[model samples]
Target: MQRVAIVGPGGAGKSTFAQALGERTDLPVVHLDRFFWRPGWVETPRDEWRQRQSELFAGDRWIADGNYGGTFDDRFALADTVIIVARPRLACVVSAVGRSARFHGKAVQAAGCPERFQMVFYRWIWNYDRDSRPRLDIALARHDHLDVVELSTRMSMTHFLESISVR
Candidate 1:
């Protein structure tokens, strides 16, 4: 795929998958977290965030990984393929917790944005299927022409990766 959009809830391995996919396809990887957060967990202004997303999506080839609902439409419109990493809530929670522990007080995905565990984030992960999936579904519906790959398990993700015939 030329323009790939990797999306899912926090700790769903979107960044990891996007990195792997980018390596396999020789495409540049764009971590939206890097652009969305300013510093110290501060958020970028909505207008500026959207503008930045547009510029990122304007690229010819790239693997963007994030779940910024506000700019989903713009990214999806430009993406030729969408990869949804849909792991179980328990797995996501565990992954997120472990990541936070490993990267606490240090930036991981975004510069100047130290990782930290939050109950609210965990709650969002736990309720992603019920609360967020519906919105994702609607968004996906809007772009039926695009190839959408949903990896519901680790094995499935591996299988999908292995199936890609990268040059």
Candidate 2:
């Protein structure tokens, strides 16, 4: 997959998977969340976000991680493969909690990090309800041209990674 997009609910390990895939394939990896979020967790304007995405996809090979509905069409058009990380809601919540702790502990100053009065773990877990998954489902359906690989369980994700031929 020359251009792969990793999609799924927040805290689903999409960023980690994208990083791993980028290492394995020796391709550039782009975290969509980083692009969408400005300093202090403020969202970048839609037009600006789209313009940045356009620049990233202009390259031939990249592994993009995160689901920004605003740029779905632009991203899908450039992606040859779509890897959906469909972990259970509970698992997603747990992961988010852990990630929030680790990220904050490290003091990784980034636009996406939750700032004053916003607890990352608490916010992320409660943010996505059942409606979010259906949105992702719709995105997959709409992008029929993409080779969709859905990993609904942790075991499946490991298996899928093992099956990929590391060039």
Best by TM-score: 1
Q: Relative to the unseen true structure, what is the C-alpha lDDT of residue 14 in candidate 2, on a scale of 0 to 100?
A: 85
Model 1, runs deviating above 4 Å: none
Each candidate: what lDDT?
A: 0.89, 0.76
Q: Give the alpha carbon lDDT tens digit for every residue of 51-101 in model 1.
A: 988988888999999998777788899999999999998999999999999
**Candidate 1 weakest ten by summed lDDT:** 67-76
Local error of candidate 1 at residue 65 (angstroms): 0.3
